[model samples]
Target: MMTTPARIRVAIQIPPSRADYAAIRRAAAQADALGADAIFNWDHFFPLGKDTSGKHFECWTMLGAWAESTSHAAIGALVSCVAYRNPDLLADMARTVDHVSDGRLILGLGAGFREWEAKEYGFEFGSPAQRVQQLGEALHRIERRMTLLNPGPVRKLPILVAADGAKALRLVARYADIWQTFAEDDAFSEKSRLLDSYCDQLQRDPATIERAVFVDGDPWTVGTRLRERGAGMFTLMTRGPDFNLDGLRRWLAWRDEHNAQASRS
Candidate 1:
């Protein structure tokens, strides 16, 4: 396992589905106020899960609002679909949001999946490999555009790549500051080890990339085990209608305890 001394960070992803934008906004603000290191929303045109036809909002626009709404926590999409917008335009949007948040934006990106949504939106739902190749190209364009922009980003905006496959892991090794995946326990450990191998081939320090995973169980239980296996950032998913933050509070407590221990060590 890749070793690092970084303190653990907690993020809360507020799914903007099945609820009004006002409720989503309140949840984002609340998560930030509750000491979440980052707040995120998923990028999708329609609602996910059982209530697929329910109300939902766009990702970047909501991020702009979140930029203004919260003061401390960083904010962005959990993973913005790369196929949804032109890379250069997306770069400009990220730069603008970074300014709005005073440099608290983490651009989480992924190759687009969900063929049904792609067909509805008139995007070509290419094969999985093709889409990942496209994502690699988009990342290059985004980095280029960031440099060309006149004022540029207020800070070195971190890029978070959400991927798990071999090619995707290669891109993560090359471009990501934070690498996030949803695998649990052994699956997560295996993928993380593969990521380290990819980083080794690229001559990049594996520990330079923060490893993040979705917390599916009790934070103290699942999260502690993942932390032991080299993951440092844990993201809790909360869905709207109510966007309950009880879980986030518990996870934040776990984060505090973990960070305190790291500092003491």
Candidate 2:
């Protein structure tokens, strides 16, 4: 099982789309006040939910603002698109944001998808397997570029890779500091176990790569069971421009209660 960072943390995904700047900023403030350990926004060109034409801000730009906006919490994208920009440039951008946040950046990255976004934005959306392969390539490029970038990241920006396929798990062992898997409750144990097995065969220290998951359902019953299986952190995606973090308050309370229990134990 994972250890260190004794108390578990909650990551709140506040994708700022469908509303105005004031609305998005308000939600961000709410997440910060609710004591979330981390705040996140999805990297997408458009809205991912019901509000297709909703007002959405770009990911990196919003994160630059989020860095200065909140204190004492890590911030990241759910997963940035490796296919959209040059990996080296992406690393540079992350380093810049890291400096802006005073070393509070967690670079969650993944292969690019969403063909419509790509086509509309003039990016090539390749096949699924190809995209995953491209993601692995991007990881390699970023790591190398990070060292060469004149002014290094304000902090050693933790690389969070997202994928559950066998190839992706192996890549996680080879490169990732954290593997972020998203799904429902029952599947958490199975995916984590599968990742553990992959870690075993690769002779990579399982502990090196943290296992983090996010759920859209109730945290009480679903999130608790996932935690029992050694899930280290949870994410609740609250979509915005009209973002309300009422759910975040409940989850943070749950996190605080658990942290206390762990301490006493």
Candidate 3:
């Protein structure tokens, strides 16, 4: 397991919907230049908002573009559905992107929740428990395939598992380098404690897995409280056509201040 990262990191998830590819590309590049620690796009075939028919793009292909467009920030899908693609194929694609980004890649995975996408795409949208089981199997294959790839990853590519339930968190404890959660406030703290227990059961240091939270609204307000509850990575989400990055700037400033204070302490 990797040591705890030094500073609080801020990331942006630029939704790949309702905007042109150019606009999305520009926003990603700008966010990277402005010092976002990571940049992300979600994996979904359709629009998540009210408008069912809206512009959208695939995940990994856009990540490949992000690899060329953004030089600094790590790029990835916020959480790719393991069921959508074959595990070995996905691992190979990730390895390719890791090389494209010169190792600035974080492979985020989830059991997958969107049944509509699965049905439309002709995938087996199994029950929640079944999907979790599938995810565990795929993760094992992904890890094994990564080792077998000819060029391999540029580094031991970090695995960020977005999990909220006990079953999923168990997978996280065994496989993840970072654990991303959507639970907040008291719920967030409770889940953190639960994850700690899982790590203990596995004889893994809880500190080895960095905590990430996906948040909206005032970054400082959300981030400040979560920071105390073991969140070291904060992800702010923005949707296009106007991918407003004003919030990202504020979060970056707060991260800088927090890191500086930690260093001084």
Candidate 4:
């Protein structure tokens, strides 16, 4: 059996964009009070839920705001679109945010999706294959620029890339410090196996790539199982006007239970 790590944490994905700043603020403050490890907002022009142009906050800007509000808990975009900003600019922004957060920033990134959002912003909504191709290149440029930046990052920004595709996994192996995946589905086990296979095929130590999965379903049912399948961290995504603070609290309780159980073993 695998030994449990000492710092098991629960994260809350804060959806500030779709909700009011006051509401998002309340959620962030509450989640921090409730002892969440990290908080995030998705990078997008419009809301992914009910409203399109609703009172949505921008990703980096909101993350900066979140940084100021909460003393504890890491803050980041759930997955920033590498396609939106130039790699150097994105690196600088991430670096700046990292400093602002006092090294509590996670640079979660992925290729641009949502063609409508891109077109509205005048960003090229390229084909899926092209986007994936660009994602790898973007990561390379970002890393290079991060090294060349004036102060360097306050801390090595944890590069969190999403998905379990072969190229995605390879990129994760090559550059990412954290591999984020949506292991909430029924087929999560199969995808987890594929992630391991990719690591093996790339000759990268699977343990080096910290698994960061988005939590779905019952925390009690899925929490420990996810850790067993290779997830080192699980982010609970709470969407809407409420932002589900209660749900995150329950999930935190589950994380504590899982950690306690693992410790006893």
lDDT of 3: 0.91
lDDT of 2 by residue, 1-265 (tens): 4333456778888876877877777777777777888888888989885657867789989999988888878999988999888999999999999999999999999886688888898988888888888988999999999999989998778999988777777778778888898754556666666777778887877767777888656677766777777777888887654566777777788888889988998
CA lDDT, every model vs. true structure:
0.91, 0.81, 0.91, 0.80
For residue 33, give model 4's deviation from the true position in Å. 1.5
Residue-level lDDT tens digits of model 4 in 71-167 = 8898888799989999889999999988887888999899877998899989998887888889999999999999999998987788989866777
Predicted candidate 3 versus true structure: per-residue lDDT over 91-210, tens digit per residue:
999999999999999999999998988899999899989999999999999999999999999999999999999999999999999899989989988888898899999999999899
Model 3 clash pairs? Answer: none
Q: Give the runs in model 1 whose Cα sits over 4 Å from its true position.
A: none
Better of 2 and 4 by TM-score: 2
Off by over 4 Å in 4: 1-7
Off by over 4 Å in 2: 1-6
Question: Where is model 1 poorest over a 10-residue stretch in terms of lDDT?
Answer: 1-10
**TM-score, every prediction:** 0.98, 0.93, 0.97, 0.91
**Candidate 2 minimal-lDDT segment of 10 residues:** 1-10
